[model samples]
Target: MNILVTGGAGFIGSHLCDLLLLQGHSITVVDNLLLGRKENISHLLNRDDFSFMKEDLLNLPVLKHIFENGRFDMVYHLAANSDIQKGSKDPGVDYDLTFNTTFNVLQCMKEYDVKKLFFASTSAIYGETCDRLTENYGPLRPVSNYGAGKLASEAFISAFSSAYHIQTWIARFPNVVGERFTHGVIYDFIHKLQANPEILTVLGNGEQIKPYLYVKDLVEGIQFICEKACERFNVYNLGSDSRTKVKEIAAMIIEEMGLDARIEYTGGDRGWVGDVPEFKYDLSKINELGWCAKHDSNASVRLAIQKALGK
Candidate 1:
């Protein structure tokens, strides 16, 4: 099967591309290299079965041209704005990169008669919820622009799947961490420590808890669900069974980097305005399908830290 991964040069997408290639599938990666780094997929650049196109997804004409010719069997829409905080400052950031990216991809896919699509969604769409979120969690009121944009994309994906007969898989994800990571808590923590080894400033109350999953686990879960879940439009939550705190992650990073830095608190519950300080996942849906994350939240954080530190 021929596959098209939208953000194939990013951390998670690159890993997915690697697995797809190993499984004897031809992979075509289209990443504008905004949130995605070219180095992540550099090793596969020379492969005959793997092709990388440095093009933005917003360009409908170019996207149409590519889709008309490549003849993709499936599309993993992994492209999105990585920085959630940016959306709080400028709403257009998420509108252009997050929502618009998915919108254009669907249009081209519909035009080209692409049958299957796998959308990369986030836990942020659930908003500030106290309950462990399921895929069917009601009245999704996303606080962050990133979440809102993702929700909008999901809506369109569903609409397109129903109208055009496209088989769609939407996986709401947790804090995905691993090698070649460019954004999120672990990446930010390491970069901060590198800049100033003496003092580490943590935002929020340092008690913000959320699930963290290894990128490998996330990719594997998606693969399993795709093979097993048969529906016109499938939505599932992909995450670790457990959860982790902000301060816990800071401590992990400090220990991994061997830093003797003082931890300072910014005195708030959320790291940012739209930040959901606490959220959990009920993985019963995917677990019922006989798939569970191998690494717990703590293990995932530890592994991501080690990889980030090059240890």
Candidate 2:
């Protein structure tokens, strides 16, 4: 199978590319290097079955050429403005990057008659809901601009699926933590400790909790769903069964580093204005499909810290 992975030079995207390449599939990556680093995919640049285009997804002409030329068997769209706090700062930037780029991809898919598209959605789309989130959880009241953009893009994809008759899969991801992570709670904590080495300044009250997933587990689960599940439009939540608090994550990082750093907290309900205080997901749907996570939240965080520290 010929696969095109947008933002394939980033952390999760690069790992996805590695998985596809190992499966004996021809992979072409398109990345602009805005947030994605070239070193992520540097090893695969010499492979005969792997190619890359250094371009943004908003470039329709370039994207169209790739679609028309590669004739991709499937597209895994993971490129977008992923920073929730940054998105809250400048929503117009988020809208253009997330919504506009998604529209461009859909247009290219329609023009080239692409068969299937797997979209990377977010758990932020659920906002602060009362009940545990399910696939059927409704109204999509996103509190953050990043979440709003993702929700809007999901709607566009659903509309395109109905109007153009394309197969689409939407996976609402929790906090995906692993190596090569450019920015996130884990990365932030590690960097801060590295810089200070004495006191770690933690954002928020550190009581906020959220679900997390290891990158390898996430990729594996997606592979299973893509191979077995067949639906014009499918939506599922991808996350680990366990949840971890912010303070717990900080302590784990401190322990992993073998440091006696003091944790200082900034009192608040959340780290940021648009951040979700607490949320948990129901992963029974994906688990019922015979795909289960090997690592719990704490174990995943420890592994990610180890990798990030090059230990």
Candidate 3:
């Protein structure tokens, strides 16, 4: 299958591209290089089954041209402003980069007669929920611009799928960590400790517990869901079965790096204004489909740290 992956040069997206290429799919990557590094996809530059386009999806004309010429059978939409911490600082970033780009992608899909879309939705859309979030969980309140944009993009994808007979898969992912990770707690902690080994500045109270999934696990989970749950519109919560606290992650990083840094907290449940301190997803839906996450949250964190430290 010839497929297109937007933001395919980023952390999870690059991993997805690697998996798809291994599965004998012709993969074309479209990335703006704003947050996605070229080196992430540099290894695939010579493959006959792989191609990379240094273009932004926000440019509708360029996107349309690519779609018309490339004739992609399916699209994996992962392009968006992923920096949740700074989402509040610039409101327009999510609008222009995330939601607007989604709208354009759907439009191009419709215009090009493409019938399939795989959207990369986030767990942030649940918005500080006390209950274990399910795919059906609603009120769908997103506290940050980043989450709001993802939720909005999900809505557009759903509407487009139904209206145009496009098959769609929407997977809400937890904090994904593994190789080629550009940002996240693990990445930040590694960089911070490298600079100042004596003290590690922990965000929030270090009590913020959330589920983490290894990138390889996430890619496989997505593949499993896409293969098993074929529907006009599908939604699933893709995450690990258990949760891990922020302090645990920091400790793992510090221990792995052989550093004795004092963990310092800024004191808050939420790390930033829009940060959701703790949340878990009921993976029963995907689990029932014969897909279970292999790594628990702690193991995922440890593996991510090892990969980030190049071990």
**What lDDT does each candidate get?**
0.92, 0.89, 0.92
Cand. 1 Cα-lDDT:
0.92
**How well does model 3 score by local distance difference test?**
0.92
The true-structure Cα RMSD of candidate 2 reads 1.0
- Report the lDDT tens digits of candidate 3 across residue range 191-237: 99999999999878999999999999999998887788888899999
| Deviation of model 1 at 220, angstroms | 0.6
Q: For residues 231-260, what per-residue lDDT tens digits would candidate 1 score against the true structure?
A: 999999999888999999999999888888
Find the 10 residues in a row with the least total lDDT in model 3.
223-232
lDDT of 1 at 62: 94
Taking all chains together, the TM-score of candidate 1 against the true structure is 0.98
Q: Could you estimate the TM-score for every candidate?
A: 0.98, 0.98, 0.98
Order of quality (lDDT): 1, 3, 2
Q: Could you tell me which 10 consecutive residues in candidate 1 have the lowest summed lDDT?
A: 218-227
TM value for model 3: 0.98
Candidate 2 residues 165-274, lDDT tens each? 88888888899999889999999999999898899999999999988889998888778778777889988898888889999999999998999999999999799968
